[model samples]
Structure formats: structure tokens, C-alpha cells
Target: MAEAFTIRYIQPLWFIWVIIAVYIVFYAVFNHTEINVGAYWFAVITIAYILISAFVNPRDEMYASIIGMPLGILWAMYERKIDSYFEIGFLRKEIVAIVAFVILFIGRLTLSVVGFDNQLFQSVLRNIITIAFIVPLIELLKKVKIQKRFLIWLGTISYEIYIIHPFILYFFEKETTEGKQVGNLEIVLWTIGLTLLLSSVLQIVQDNLVRKVKL
Candidate 1:
């Protein structure tokens, strides 16, 4: 809902790079204190999710109940012209974007140093950082193409995928070794195959249901 707005806008590589730089600045707030990069990454995934979860929208850290529901209603109320919000002169200002980036960067850096190394404190701090930068990130992402097909497909079934994917993963893991590492590429392919198959069927069923209700 937030990101559907900037698709046709000009997004230079530098623009994308600047956004990456912003995210890094925001991220480094928690990270620069730690000298080891590998340990830093290990900490990000300390939540016991599968490796693919970090990159998959169905498994993204953000949730529909938390993020999707309100946005869904808002997108409806706006009649899907939510992208036009970017047309505001203040929001489109380069200086506004830069200030947003720097404030986010400095705030996080300050938090990182002041908060020290407490994990719970850092988690709360990161959420604060997200509050500072999420607007700019969404502003930047709509113009950028991370994975066009995946984004479109996920956008279409964004709510459903979150619910369906867990079940797919549960069954796939259940039928397999369950506890051991899945080292086979074929097994990974099978997971992909199953997700596509099941998700397509679900989408079809959902479309039929929506059509019946005229929604």
C-alpha cells in the first residue's frame, strides 16, 4: 500500500545508492559497536528462522496484522491514488530526503553508543530507528525494483502468503528429515515447486470467493 506510488518516477542509481546508504546508516547504529561483521549478521538472524525467511516477503519481519490491515483500509479509502502523496513539494525535496537520512543515521549512531550492548535495549532502539526512517525507505523503494515479479505477486497475495507459507514450510519440513540440514538442491527445488503449486491453487480459490462476494 505504501510502496505502490513511485513506479514511474525517476530513480537514479545514486538515488538507490543513497537509500542503501540511509539504511546502512540506520543499521550501523546497532552494528558499528560490534567489530566482527560475521557476528553482527549472526545477531540479525538470532530469531531462529530459516535462511530464506530474511528475503521472502511471505516470511518478512513485517506482519499484515501489524502493517497490512491499516494500510489495506487506507489504500481503499484513498481509492488507490496513495502514490500521489509523493507529489507533495516538501516530501519531494532533495534536502528533505538528505536531512531525513542524516537524522536517522545520527540518531541510531547515538543510540548505539549510548545504549551499549544490551540485546533487549538494542531491539527497542532499532524499532525507534525504524520509526525514524521507514517513511523515506518506502518513498525510495517504490521507485526501485528489488524483484519486480516477486513484488507484484506478493502484493497480489501479500496477506494470504504469510498465512499459507508457514503451512507449506511445516509440511515440507515434516515430510523431510525434520531435524537435519537439507543439503540437497533437489529438496530445495521441491520446496519451491510445492509453494508455487499450493499458492496458485489458493489464489484461484480466493479469486473465486472474492468474485462471488463482488469484492
Candidate 2:
């Protein structure tokens, strides 16, 4: 379980950060003229790596997220651009971007689902599909007016939730293995609720500690 988790989650996170740092350095050293160009290059390199990895080592599925990191960064950059459009009430460019994103998303998903069983290829396609989905999803989110207080709190603590949820899962598994008679649905609900509460507390503690250290 530890090995599988490391391979599936930890290694991919490390790989993505390494690639992101490399791209950041490359942009700073060579072409600080425009960030969008850097994002484009990062996207291109990520895609190229995916394709190459597909041919070279089709079994390594973790490398697929190499593309996802850049695509996420690119989406962030694009979100900034769209903010500018929103300010000026000029949505034509955003609309075009959304349409392109939809097309690429569909293509990527189709390839991922219906294409060959090659791990590398499927993983690359999945990364592309996720990347393609981010743009339009963000665009749609921009139009949404979310006003719920609980939702706002959830959003604030989301990063903590993400980090702590795995521990919750682990604890759930341990409990079940020890013959705890919790139902599956009960375990899931308890995990989620406990994760939320614990993560929020953790975040508060972290914030306070940071403040104290800064002082």
C-alpha cells in the first residue's frame, strides 16, 4: 500500500514540481519577455515528454501528470487573461478559448477511453483531457455567483482538506481491518466529516504559528 501510494501520488507530485521549477528557471534565464510564451513552451515540452514516454516506456503511468502541471499553470495564466476581458466586457476571445478547450477535451477523452491499452498513451491522453477541461470549467466558474457561507469556508480550507483526506482514509482502513463494524457509507461520511473538521483545525493552527513566527 505504501509503495503503491508513493508511486501513484508522491512521485507524480515530485515530478510535477521538478518540471515546474525547471520551466520557471528556463523562462527566467532565456525568455522573460512574456509569461504566456513560457506557458506555451511548458505545455509543448510536457506534451512532447508524454509522447516520447509513451513510445519509450509505456508502463510508467505516473509521468502522465507531467503534462497536467503545466496545463494547470497555463490555465492559471489564461484565467488572468480572462479577468482582463471580463473587466472590458470583451468575451469574444474567452469564448473562442472555451470552444477550443471543449474540442481538445473531447478529442483527448475519446482517445483516452477508446484508444489502445498502452499505459503511457492513455495517461498522456488523460492528462490532456484534464488540462482541456480546466479552461472552460474556470470560465464557467467565473460566471457563477456562489454565496453560501459553508461553501466559502470549504473553499478556504480546501488545500488542507486535500492534504488531510488521505490520512482520514488510512484511519478508516485501519479501523475496518481491526474489525470495527462501521458500514462503508458510514465510514465514508465519517471520514469526510472528520477530515473537514481536522483540516480546518490544522489550518488554523498553521496560520497562528506562522503569525507567531513572523512576529
Candidate 3:
């Protein structure tokens, strides 16, 4: 069980760590610098990495996500300024973003249904669509009033949910491989429930450990 869990989780763990480390270093260097060369350098590096990965290991989708790191940094740095501009009342930036997101999402689905199998193009398109969806969605969410304790709890555990849900999915898929026919809805529900439970437990354990260390 330990070996199986390790095998299933190691790559994702490593990938997340690498992303975090890269983002930290990138942010540190550019955050205080007068001349922001981070984006330029990141673009160059990302292009090179993509080209090499495409030629050498075309099967790897990791490079596609890595390319978005610099963009994330850029967005973070300018997000407040962008948000202020979008808040101008008449521009309706959120509505525009939502429309674009829906159009792109539908277009992607239509293309897929029609047998569009260009991985690189699809990956790029998906990234763009995600950014379009998320930016405005986040802006809109900022105005939402959360009165439910469960939703508040879910928000607190969201990161852990993201990290642990893949393992849950993998475990269920493995069970299916061993002859258990788990339906899609069952898998989704199980993944969510298990993720929330595990993350909450882990968070409590971490808090206790921190208190013990401080003591």
C-alpha cells in the first residue's frame, strides 16, 4: 500500500514542488528589481523548454503547465491594478471575461467533438480559456457573501483538496482495475468526501505539531 501510494503520488508531488520553487525564485528576483527582466527571461526559458520537450518527449504535458508559471507571476503583480481598471462600472470587464470564457470553452468542445487532436494547440487554447474564466470568476467571487459554514470550511481546505483528490481518484481507478466497477458519480463523491476528511485531519495534526514544537 505504501509503495503503491508513493508510486501514484511522487510525480505529482515533485511537479508541485518544482513549480512552487520556480515561482518563488522568479518572484523574489523580480519583485524588488527596478528593471523587471523576469518575464522576458521566463518567456525565453519557457519557449526553449517547450521546443525541447516537444522534440524530445512529445508525450509529456508538464511543459505546457510550466509555461503558465511566468504568466501567473505577471498576473499576480498586476492583478490589483487590472482589477481597479475593471471596476470602472461601465466597462463590465467581468461580463466580457465570462463571455469570452464561454465562447472559447464551447469552441474547444466543438473542436474536440469534430476530431481536433492537435495536442499543442489544444493545450494552449485550454490555458487561455482557463485564464479567461478564472480572472473574472475570482473578481466576482470577491463580492460574494458566504453565510454557510460548510462552504467556508471547504474554502479553507481547498488547497489540500486539490493536492489529495488526485490520489483518491487514482486509488479508485486502481480498485476498478482490480474488478470493482465504480461509477463516475461515485468516484467524484468519494474523492470529494475523502479529500475533505483527510485534509481536515491533516490540518489538525499539523496545527498540533506546530503547537508542540513551539512549546
Candidate 4:
């Protein structure tokens, strides 16, 4: 498996040119608000230069492109060692859950007392937190797993995870939102549990679809 991944490091120069051209086209199209004819032409010229450099210095190009990622990860580890126990000290999952419950309960009481009605603010904050913390943590956790097969399978089914989540949200969203708002423990648990359960099942279906296409 390692050897298979290593082989991709020597992809043909033509593919690099193809990548550069496609990038120029897509970037120009996406940035039409700022990209004028001169800017587009300059971008094309710059992309050509990058491709030329890649072809002329294949090893350097390959290392510059891929090597920095792992090095950056190692540098992060060097700065802050992973002390999971210390980080999560005295707080088991259940304790953490209880803490979250207490915080939400207090927040609800405070909001009622203050007569605050900022549903939009709450929704925006939830989205910001999910994108900033949850999504990145999920991706980092995925990388830490030592199982190659697990990662491969996850990669295969990630599209389904992304696509099916909206449908699941649409179906259970009202009940889930109401439960959370009312601080209903049972509904909160059931919503999370069902979402995960259904998402996993959908992943399997997506994997089958991917296999059919690849085969």
C-alpha cells in the first residue's frame, strides 16, 4: 500500500500541465469579479511558468508539493506533544456530557431571564463552531487513525457522507431543533444517534456504488 502511494509521487509532467491549465480556467472563471483580460493572461503565463518549473525540476516540484504537509504535521507535534490524558483530565465522556448539559441548562435559564431572542445569532454561531472546530477536528482525527483500509473506505464513502447529510437534516431537523431548544435529553440523544446510524448505513450504500463504477 505504501509503495502504491509512493508511485504517485512520480506522476507524468503532462498531468502537471493539465492540472495547471484546469486551475487557470477554473480560477479565472471563479474570480471574474476581479480578473480582467490582463489578469487572466498574466495568470495563464504564471501557470505556464509553474508547469515549466515542475517539468524542469521534477524531484524538487514533487517534494515541494507533498513533503511540506508531513513536515508541518511533525513540526506541530514537536511544539505540543499529545497528552490526551492531561488534555481531557478528570473528564470522562460522561463527565463531559454532564458539563455540556449543565452549561446548556444555565444558558437556557439566562436567555429566558434576559428575554433574549437571538435564534439567528445562535444558528450562525453553531455553524461557525461546527465549521471551525468540528469539521477540522473530524478531519484531523481521520488522519490519526493507523488503519489504511479504514482511511481508504472512508475516502470512498465521503461523498455519500457529504450528500446524504442534508437529506437527513431535512427529515429530522425540526424534531432535533425543537428538542435541543426545549432541552429534551431523550430527543437530543435520539437525534444524534439516529443521524450517525443512518449516515453509516448510507456510507455502505455509497461504497457499493463506488465499487460498481470502478469495477
By TM-score, the best candidate is: 3
lDDT of 4 at 173: 56
Q: Number of clashes in model 1?
A: 0
TM-score, per-candidate, Cα-based: 0.42, 0.56, 0.64, 0.27
lDDT of 1 by residue, 180-199 (tens): 66656866677667766777
User: What ranges in model 4 sit over 4 Å off?
Assistant: 1-115, 135-143, 155-159, 165-215
Lowest summed-lDDT stretch of 10 residues in model 1? 63-72
Query: How much lDDT does candidate 3 score?
Result: 0.69
- After superposing candidate 2 on the true structure, give the runs of residues whose Cα lies further than 4 Å from its correct spot: 1-61, 85-102, 112-114, 201-215
Task: In model 1, state the lDDT of residue 151.
Answer: 71
Among all windows of ten consecutive residues in candidate 3, which has the lowest summed lDDT?
206-215
The C-alpha lDDT values of all candidates are 0.48, 0.63, 0.69, 0.45
Ranking by TM-score: 3, 2, 1, 4
Please state every model's RMSD to the true fold in angstroms. 18.1, 7.0, 6.5, 19.1
**How many backbone collisions does model 3 have?**
0
Instruction: Tell me the deviation in Å of residue 163 in model 2.
Output: 3.8
Write out the backbone clash pairs for model 1. none
Clashing pairs in 4: none
lDDT at residue 196 of model 2 (Cα atoms): 92
